[model samples]
Target: MDFIDEHLNHIKDKGLYRDFKFFTSSQSKYTSIDNRRVLLMASNNYLDLCADDRLKEAAEKAIYTYGVGSGGSRLITGSCKLHDQLEKKIADFKGAEAAIIFNTGYMANIGTITAISDQEWIIFSDELNHASIIDGCRLSGAKVVIYKHCNLDHLQEKIKIHQGKKRLIVTDGVFSMDGDIAPLDKIVELAKENKILTMVDDAHGTGVLGDNGAGSVEHFNLKGDIDIQVGTFSKALASEGGFVVGSKSLIEYLRHKARSFIYSTALSPVTIAVSLRSLDIVKNEREPRVKLLENSKWFQAKLRKLGFNVLESKTAIIALIIGNAAKARKLSEKLFEEGIFITAIRPPTVPDNTSRLRITLMSTHNRKDLKFALERLKKAGMELDVI
Candidate 1:
């Protein structure tokens, strides 16, 4: 097949092409697109800290001091005092012995999984695990076993089958599409009994769960038992980066052997500085997270009262199951037209028949916005016949 023809044929056959909008304003309740301002319900800025002025000032200060960009990879020239401090700060925040930063969540997961796993190790992952984790498992060359989503018994069965090999149980703290949390305590106990290592990608959990926003590990009070806590700054931290926290030796090993970290440029100084400041904000300004949780609870309650099938979650993610790709997309576009912009997730991002509207909440959204969102969603639901 000719190159352009082949690509065009693929797009036409699968309906996979997508176009993105450019936002001209801060990622808050309202975003500008096509010269129209609409309420945004699609961003992962859970805490609404992404465009915080203090953090931006910190980033600007960092740029003045360190200049823009890390000129080389961390192993060669990008490693800086700021990076070391950020790592230490993250370790302390997450109650880990040490931490190491990565350029992105995908790199962090892939690099760690590939670097530490071996043939003798079996990577037991949940069926609904993120694509990054799936790719990581493939890179590890370890035997990958898929367990049922949040089904402890099924996971135990897989563990039984792979018992002979070293076990590495991996799961996402918050299932992105389903808006459900993992059975962490159950998984932790099972792994301990089986002497298996455990890894959790808390990309959505951090800065949204637990008292101090320490995430799932602290939410379950399973300190030191769970082996690794992988997180990203792009979500709650309002910056662009990722990191993995573990024991001192484990992080040191990653520093030496995680090819993604060793070869890829480190997170820029501005990002590190901004994340560090955001951490402080999460630690001290407790009211925002408190409001965030309150908003989530109220929104869920309102959705149920309005006869919408809002998926249950202890975090900021709310998934309204629409079940058909075309219908989901239509509903999302309708919501946007109604001035409540939500993202419609369809097949491949989810299973074939489980398309949904992924509505995320932020502390900045008050009762008025929530009420308006609920109204618009109800209207969309009626239009799509999803309710």
Candidate 2:
């Protein structure tokens, strides 16, 4: 207990401690936090479907039909008709032979990685991959080789150096922190050349990229090329649960070997229903996706014009870098005071001296909302001397 307090104090002193801001209202472009309405710029609800009437109706209908709670794990009574339906729908949506659902994206990554690889295997991972992927690599007991962020040449060199019969190359399709898209096309070329298995966790890309919003694979026109594809419904889909789509044999293998899937209770039927409805809506509603990307581009340009160090991104995420952690926190607090809600990402989440504001956009946010945000940001930047 003393050690825990010491650790907490140390983090607080360094401005690395975190706490939650409870939201009373539904997740939307604008929501209530601490009973105060603010423009939300930190959520992953890219399609703004979290508060959609259609999704709410779907949840209600599912509740009436199936009741709440999954009752047990998937291999037991928890495997309902909705679960089966959603899995099939996800497989079709991602253009895979089959799919298996997990409790979370974290569980999916860990289970998939640990189940497939062992001490004998070798894994090539990106330096900026999500924490779950990093945990999975560590848990797998495989020889993990980290390549420089989005550096194909580094990945090629690492691939050449790490010789193994069972080799895997895994990366995040859209990096959650940096707001950069992985060069999956070039990575695939490297993998094929080296005969290594490839995996992509498209948690941030699903329902936000590609012609049909299938994700990064579709965005890059390499649908059937990647060996393993992992994604989540909680982000752009505005639902719950994670899923991995691959070959039928791979799905079967995960069913038997993935401990997270085997041990955890399945997602409720209501969640599955919402995910199903959201998928249908996302596939058909291209206007929102287009509008969202357009908004991201416009907002990034505006931030840059205001002299913020904004990262280049093709997706709906914007990373505004503020090198000092305490200063970044202060900037975020100032923005919140001005009725803008943007979380300040800090150390451990990002490398030291790279604290940033991870601004995500929703399609429902029009130019007016963006302009309001930009105005607040400009004022805060001036006050904090961030510009």
Candidate 3:
């Protein structure tokens, strides 16, 4: 445990140590943290479905009808009618031929990426992709080539230098930390010209982008062009599972070959129920999506007007870049002191000297709530000389 202590000390010295903050209440406008009611802006519950009364009832019904846990992996004893129905619902929502669920967004990426490619394949990945995608690529035994973040020219140049039967290009639909959308349309066009497969992890985009919240691919109008679309229910969908949407053949292949799916226990009955209902809400309700985007744009505009660097974000996620880790931590602490709850994201989650506050907006956040957060943020920025 000496190495563990050393590493912890090293991170602490750099102001990059991550300590968990527990919330006593459900995800909402206010949550109890350290016995204080703080305005919650640090969560990914974009649509505010996490604490909906309907979902709570659905959870109760599901637990009563299907029991507490899935007994085993789907291949063994876990497959149920609810799982099948949920998968179908997901496929329809994504406009894909089929979809398969996994225990988490991380597992979905790891399983899908590793299953589709091998050591003989070459993967062209964006530099700022999520850690799950990075890990998946590493585990795939594939030759990985990383291009500059959202730089189409760099991606094209890298692609030209590589030749392989199975060349895959992977990127996040919406960057988690940077809060920017990938150039999916351009990526699809490039992939077609090179006959390469394209994959997008739309975890942050699902239930928050495009018409009826079909996700970033729909926003880009590249539904059939993209090969694989992976998303999660834990974020805007307000549940606890992940899914991959693709062709029927691809789904069947994953069912047989994806080690994460084959080995891990299936998602619980209550989660599946919650996810199904959440998807219905995401598809049927236009108000939440519209309000969330409007809130994000308004908040980002306000930040920019306050002389804070709000990165190019067209979605509910926003990032305020503070170059130094210590400064970012100080800003976050300042916000907390003012009864606002936001987090400082530092390395290795982000690059050194680019630490930021990964602020996420929700539809449920009213103007008053936002004003409070903004005021706190302004004070922090002014005090820190960050504005």
Global lDDT scores for all candidate models: 0.87, 0.95, 0.93
- Top TM-score: which candidate number? 2
**Per-candidate total of colliding backbone pairs:** 0, 0, 0
Residue ranges of candidate 3 with Cα displaced over 4 Å:
none
Off by over 4 Å in 2: none
Taking all chains together, the TM-score of candidate 1 against the true structure is: 0.96
Rank all candidate structures by their lDDT, best first, as comma-separated numbers: 2, 3, 1
Models 1 onward score TM values of 0.96, 0.99, 0.99
lDDT, candidate 3, at 369: 96
At residue 141, give the lDDT of candidate 3: 99
RMSD of each: 1.6, 0.6, 0.9
Q: Is candidate 1 or candidate 3 better by lDDT?
A: 3
User: Which 10-residue window of candidate 3 scores lowest in summed lDDT?
Assistant: 22-31
Q: Compare candidates 1 and 2 on TM-score and give the better one.
A: 2
Candidate 1 has which clashing residue pairs, if any? none
Residue 240, model 3: lDDT of: 93
Expressed as tens digits, the lDDT of each residue in 60-81 for candidate 2 is 9999999999999999989889
